[model samples]
Target: MSEHGFWSRFLLPGGLWLFLLFVVPICLVLALSFGYTDDLGRAVYAFRLDNYADAFDPLYIPVLLRSIGYALATAAICLLLGYPIAYYIARYGGRHKHLLIAMLVIPFFVNYLVRTYAWVALLADEGLLNSLLGDVGISEIQFVNTPYAVIGGLVYGYLVFMILPIYASLERMDGSLIEACQ
Candidate 1:
């Protein structure tokens, strides 16, 4: 085989996997979105735009906006927090940079569900944090079931994804440019 054909053969498995796993599901969902329910409440596949219209209806618009706002808030929080830590690790981590990065990543070794449950345990009104505060004569604070809680959870979940990329870019950057800017 030619060099081009040899290289192309290596892509077959991954391409097939993507087509089967990602593209097919997305196409199926897209097709289903235009469907509607029948009189018997069974889903009927049809070329209708009602679902899209209902999604943008005024009543639901606020919910959509709120979701977007939460996403923006989470991204902003991640950038604000991740940048400093990434910069510190990149610039001053010295020979311990890998160790510091490992520490940051170790939490991700736990299952995501377990980490979230840990957060719930710590933040629940009757949980550890509130109990500790209660011991100090403070009333229990409701930390769960709040917008802040949702955002905090998102930030915690995604912060490492943000930090690693920033750290990579900073590591590749020339130190002289940063010194010159200062």
Candidate 2:
């Protein structure tokens, strides 16, 4: 393609897409940040930093710290779990690579509520896991309504969120070295 052809066909269109979809919305949100909400909670556009100041209030410190802790923990766990799965799929998926990726992605098509409820059922006192344990003469273990349940749910719920990016990165990597490594 010629210089003009490349610029017009790709760069210009790509830049326009970025400006419209990403930049414009961010600029609008940035402008709105200096504004205030009305009594009925409608946004009132006005210049003020009061909202920004309130965001750093000492009362919110613990909440902020807790959020940071949760984010760090989630990231650590996701990295540990996602990297190997992604690597395996990318490096050795072979003829079934698309099938594997589709399987990983299919859960996103299901309703989030349905998945959560399924987890609840699986973890309930009289649920599948406990019942299986009981059948094996093991004591019924409480799995639901606890911190472990919450963390397990979080990990399960967001596992795909972690996996997809890692898979993408791995898939995009140069693969000639993979056979050499093997």
Report lDDT (CA) for all predictions. 0.96, 0.86
Go through the candidates in order and give the clash count of each: 0, 0
| Best by the lDDT measure | 1
TM-score of model 1 (CA atoms): 0.89
Backbone steric clashes in candidate 1, count = 0
Tens digits of per-residue lDDT for model 2 on 1-182?
Answer: 78898678678878999999999999889989999899999989899999889889999888788767777777778789988999898889999999998998888798888988999999889999999999999998898877567667777778888888988988998877767899
By summed lDDT, the worst window of 10 consecutive residues in model 2 runs over: 145-154
Worst 10 residues of 1 by lDDT: 36-45
lDDT of 1 at 100: 96
On TM-score, the leading prediction is 1
Q: Can you write out model 1's per-residue Cα lDDT over 1-182, one digit (the tens) per residue?
A: 89999988999999999999999999888988999888999878899999999998999999999999999999999999999999999999999999999999999999999999999999998899999999999998999999999999999999999999999999999999988999
For model 2, the local distance difference test gives 0.86
lDDT of 1 at 35: 97
